[model samples]
Target: MTGGDEPAPARVQAKVGAAVLAGIGPRGAEGTDGARPHSDGGAGARSRSEETVDVRFPFEGTVGLWELLDDMAAAPRLVVGDERVRAFLVDVGRRLRAPEVARRHPELASLGFFLRRSELERAAGPLPGAAGSLPGAAGSLPGAAGSLPGAAGVGGAGEFVRVPRGLVFHVAPANVDTVFVYSWALSALMGNRNVVRLSARAGGTAQAILTIMRDALDDADPVVARTQRIVSYGHPRPGARRIPVEPPHKQLEHASPGHHASSDHHQGEHSGKPPRTSPVTHPEPVAPADAGSGGAAGPTAVLSAACDLRVIWGGDRTVNEIRRHPLAPHARDLTFPDRSSFAVIRARAWLEATPATRETVADGFAIDAYWFDQAACSSPGTVFWVGSPIECAMARDGFAACLAEAVARRGWTVDTAMAVEKRVAAYGLAADGVADAVEFHGNVLAQVILTSPGAAPRRWLGTGTFAHARIGSLDELADVVRRKDQTLTHFGFDRDELAGLARALGGRGVDRIVPIGNALGFHRVWDGVDLPAELSRVITVQ
Candidate 1:
């Protein structure tokens, strides 16, 4: 996929191997061996596991999970707002924005924008100094200087420094390929040593991301790789048979680390496998709190118990499953659980909008819903029209026309299998008497007019399916809002109006209420957590 004569995959593999091995040890001030004293006073180092993880970034190899943690612990300490980490992340972002790369994977373009040097600086918010506080960053960020309690370090009475939270272990979702990057980057930017566990089923966009990161490492300070790792390991599901473990060295001999664009699956696209008809009640088997190395839970238990913080990104089941592996007394958990979102439009405003404006809104909404196949937690599952009955009906019709045109323009389509699923879901909604009218515009768009605003479906109804309803006013939506609701993307709503609705809900649901197009945008503060502040601890001196 490279413009170069060398095959992209082979070129990436060779470059990563050479650059990583060369700087594997701590250099310059820390020590020749690249090992720094464990900041946890050796307790973190003592929790080693023979279980191995397949290192995907910085290098491609299998190393014992505990050994990998030890390497991270041995690396030089990174202060909050570390320059080396910023420079490396900025370089990676720039490359991600390259015309060729962005054109190939448009989603990466958004990710690249999030990683821009300007964005990073804004997220770091002038560091710990005279400023001593963060400005309100984009996307409802917390404007606090310090949040986490003192983990270590001290200064003169009333003077203190913000320090890394030490080791952070991230368990990324099997779906959503690029999300792990945002989580890991935020932690790394805070100067914490981070280990991101990428799923084995992670799509090709993830592989491309790893390759790009490896390429950036050539110019990065050795400490960048020493303190950060992105690895993938197999964790068996409940009732699955155990596979024999292979020795690390033997596995490395055949390991391949490179771009695999040909294998790229659209992020959030359903695997060809049949969809599950019911919610998974049984937790995925994980190691018990005391499980030793070599079993499914071994790695999870060790990483969970050893890390200073654990970030879990997935559905409710995932959160419950990971919770089975206990963390240390001092460690904490930041979780993103199952969430539903919707779009809100003032019916009269939508109807009054000029054709061009309506078209633009439709286009933006299409990108948000279609990009992730309407399955992402932020993707709008329903459209709530606010107005009198007559205006609402007219506006809904206009919106359906515009949205149909927009979907066609983007050429978003579902396969025969998914199309069947969408039809089944739409009919099921009608049979349940929640849908008053069901309409389909080819396989790319389906609209269900809900019998009432309270009947809006929160669960996904296949890609491009939208359950729409009308309410007399924005205030009426409060009764319909549920705790599982997350993002509320709006068009033609003033800040005061949206904020009032949020206040009315009273933190019952909907953590993010943004413009329609920005549903997928990554923010430093997500799901009500101020990441930069949460990832670092503030030490105050008496």
Candidate 2:
């Protein structure tokens, strides 16, 4: 597809339809039959549906879970050295850098930059003579968690060499299509076989990334390339369900799922009361995974039983469903259940901002919230402004106007359902005496400034809708902090002081307090979990 003087293809990329899944391989007859759910997982497991999934590979092919897993079983585990992994991602970065290619998948463009040669080398830990770029090198962000009681030097000083967990299963969320790459890339770096279950509603961004990856790896890099598989199936919900998450690590054994079937919040934040608005009501009372099976949990159960590590990306409900399927005793899991995030700005900082500077700040915030249309857990759902009453009022109007313009510039897409949802949330908050004023970006988005924090938990909705509250001081934020509050983006705030506050004034909340602009910057150590470390085992040879 290049010009006359172009070089030969780097690797042969094939295009095949979804039916190609049939020809890859047959189900293994070993005790681990790829066709059915595990014995322990059959409690709530349902029969496999007769309909086929519309899954496909970008280089052009469709494959089923069994065939893909069989293909991987045939490949040996790769001993992924830092340089080789860096080389692979660099190649991928090069392809994404092409303007034509970059134009089509805008959502993934920034993600590609993280895999650039420079960023890859930096993230690989201390090079021969180079300094570490990120605070924790490869594990976590620099914060007080490092100094917590017995947690010092956890990933800091060690003699143990890391080894891959062998096979990784990723149940990616429907919200962000590109999230699978981050988890899959970490596992791949440790030389694991990966079967990623993307949302059945996955978009072109997912397909494009796989295409670049295939072309970059080709036949030459079988170690990394041959071990990867991407597939999706309709996530089943037999009876309208409410799910429970299995506690992580060794705790999975002692705990039963149904014990807290009535607990509404997964991370257990703001347990005051179910907001007057319930997203949807369950038709049937569903027991959490371990408690009872709803007889419709099939795909998740089958996939969970087959892998060594399962990285789930959906809301807690989805995680609760998947964990019900059960896992091999030796397998460990890390789940990124749903969490809420927000931003905090000092009124003095905003009041002092120049017109041009204000727009830049608005542009940055827009990027954070607009990337996934504020659907990501890291996206700021609320903005709490701390300052004098007069400064607070001005700050809200100025920032809202600037933010509205910036978001409009990005060509935000929101359907009629969401448009109505925002309006309802906006007016509902006003009626509930939660918001004093509301702003709109035409009919597509709404920004509500709350006079009281009460309505935020009750009516907070995302998809370009924002709710902000006025606070007299920073100390008030702690009262507003809920366990599920994830990221705190700030403008004109002290990172170290806030980090210390998160530790000293903690309510089991706020894992990350990043600069306003970088709230969405991917952290290798997310939710206090060292992903690379969690997916691998460390063996100490004395």
lDDT of each candidate versus the true structure: 0.71, 0.59
Q: What is the per-residue lDDT of model 1 for residues 1-542, given as tens digits with 9 covering 90 to 100?
A: 55376543233223222221122211322211234433432332343235666777667666666556555655677877777888899999998898767666677888999888889877766333323353332112222233322323423334345668988989887657788999899898888888888877665577778878877866788788778888766653223223333432333334444422222334334322122222212223342332344222256655775678999888787788777655655789999888899999999889889999999999889878877667678989999998888998899888888988987775555677778889999999999999999998887778999999999988888888899999888998899999999899999889998889989998788889999889999887688767887887766644
lDDT of 2 by residue, 377-418 (tens): 888988888898889888888888888877667665566766
> How much is the lDDT of residue 203 in candidate 2?
44
For residue 336, what is the lDDT in candidate 2? Answer: 90
**Which candidate ranks first by lDDT, i.e. highest?**
1
Q: Which run of 10 residues does model 1 get worst, by summed lDDT? A: 17-26
| Candidate 2 lDDT | 0.59
| Count of clashing residue pairs in every prediction | 3, 1
- Model 2 residue runs over 4 Å out of place are 1-65, 80-84, 124-158, 235-299, 413-417, 458-462
For all predicted structures, in order, the TM-scores are 0.79, 0.72
Residue 20 lDDT in model 1?
18
